[model samples]
Target: MKRKKILFFIYTMGKGGAARTLLNVMNNLDRNKFEPMLVTLNHDGEYEQYVNEDVQFIKLEAKRLRSGILPLAKIIRKEKVDIVFSTIPNYNMVAILAKMLSFTRAKVVVREADHVGGSLLGNLKCLVYGRFYNRTDQVISLSEGVKQNLVEKYKLKPNAIEVVYNPLDIENIKQQIEIGELSKEVAPIFNQNEKVIVTAGRLVKQKDHDTLIKAFAETNEQVKSQLVILGEGPLEEELKSLAQKLNVEDRVHFIGFQDNPYIFFHEADLFVLTSIHEGFSHVIAEALASGTPVVSTNCKSGPSEVLANGEYGDLCPVGDPKSISEAMTETLTLPPEALQMRVSKGEERAQFFNANKIVSRYGQVILNTFKK
Candidate 1:
């Protein structure tokens, strides 16, 4: 049997959720049955070290999307790639166009990474999807909500879209958490006996760190807890200003980005996500796997599904600081035994997205696509 060549394409290799999820899938692909290769707009990224040495890596030197079309097409034809699995709307559009320009027989599978109609860029992508998305061989969505948006809002055939959740490397996360140690910069913050609450993501509007700060401020002053936000973004100064305005700056610690965030999740009394929207949250799964109870907004697509409608964690209304504050306080105030039960439930739920299982699903999709 001839092994299929699977090419994973993305805009960057940066420390974003989409990039990390792609790396997880690429690293776990069945090497015996498939040849995995990576193509990035630029070769540089924090995740470059995580790529499996067995896989071939290509960098299109183009700084902009328009310049990469011809290069992408050329590589597709030259490699005789069996399938081009692309993520993010911009790259997905380019992938389909490249497949057409190259006239390659390889199937182009585009994965949608976020909720449609969630933002201006998202709405614009919906417009593009209506026009060029069906031209691709398959469309993969990270959550059922995302798939429904593609079918209902974008008017794509429901049968043509597949829902594949992000794969979480549970064992790897556990191992990393075990070996990871807190940085000296954050040591003073965690040294105290106060209860700790944590959230990790890029500090952007999408993350809604302002709401998180407000919610933290609303919590009882007697609760003696600290909020630690991991990851960095453009909203750093604004979030800090908001924290100061709310008089919680001393308790709300912005620790920037960390390569291994599982340790913080493991050590925290609670993990929360205040995102306004999400396709699927890998951090939620990571936190659950670390046995940390979570409190997240009932965002568009992911939190409700990942939390199983509040079975595994607390879910509050999006952007409601008061509800978030109450949920956080409730979780933090739960008895030790009750909290352990929630943590155990979370651990069981986390297994559903284990890397082995999710990767096998992708393998089946690849095989079925070729058979067709």
Candidate 2:
């Protein structure tokens, strides 16, 4: 059998969840059956170190997507790539356009990384995706929620989409936790007997950190606890201001991004996600793998799916501070045996997203596309 030359294209090798998921997929692909290559619009990103040495890495040297389309097309034609797999909306569109312009017979598979019902701009982009996505061979959704949104909102054919949960390297995360060192600034936050609540993600509107702060403040005042947010973004100051206004600033610790967040997850009494939306939260799975029980807003997707409707963790209404606060307090106050049972269930659920299984699902998708 001829080894299929699969080209995984992305805008960059950034540290975003989608980028990390793709890197894991590429690294775990069966090299014996498929020849994997990576193409980045720009060569620079924090995740550059994670790329496997065996995979052929190409940089278009173009700073933007518009400038890289021609270069992308040229590479597709020159390499005669068998499959062009791209993630996120912009790169997916670029991959389809490049393949069309280059007139390559390669299968173009695009992955949707977020829920589509967020803003006006997002809805408009959904329309554009609906129009152009038909040209691609397959559409991979990070969750069934995202897949249904594409089909119902965009009127896409259901058969064209596949739900492949993001891959998590549980072993790799565990290893990192073993070798991971805690930051000096965040070290003291966990030292006390107070319940420690942690959340990890970029500080942005999408993450809804404001809601998290408000909810943390609403938690039982007598219940001593600390809220540690492990990420940095444009809204850092805004979130800090919200924490101050709520009078929980002293208890809210904004420990900026850490390379190894698994350590914090391992130590946390509870992990929470107050995001307004998500396709599939890698952090939720990571937290679960670290044996931390979670509390997440029942966003458009992901949390409910990963938690299996509250079997593994608790879910609250999206953007509702009261609901989130109640869930957090309930989770925190649970009997020690009850919390441990939930944590054990979460650990079992996390294995469903093991890198090997998810990568094999991706491999099967690529192979099926090639067969067609």
Q: What is the per-residue lDDT of model 2 for residues 1-372, given as tens digits with 9 covering 90 to 100?
A: 788899999988876897898899999999878999999987687788879999999999898998888999999999999899999888888999999888878899899888865478767778888888888888898999999999976668999999999999999999988998777877888898799999999998999998888888988484789999988899999888888888888999988877788999999999999998998888999999999999999998989999998888889998999989988998899998988888899999999999999999999987898666
Assess every candidate by TM-score: 0.97, 0.96
lDDT by residue for model 1 (1-372), tens: 789999888888897998899999999988888999998886479888888899899999897887888999999999999999988888888888888888879998889888868567767768777678888888888899888888866788999888999999999999999999998988777789888999999988888988988999888474788999999899899989998888888999988788889999998899999999999988999999998999999998899889888888889999999999999998889998988888899999999999999998988887788766
What TM-score number comes out for model 2? Answer: 0.96
**Candidate 1 clashes between residue pairs 3 or more apart in a chain or in different chains:** 231-256
Model 2 scores worst on lDDT over the 10 consecutive residues at 116-125
Q: In model 2, which regions exceed 4 Å deviation?
A: 118-121
Clashing pairs in 2: none
Q: Which runs in model 1 stand beyond 4 Å of their true positions?
A: 118-124
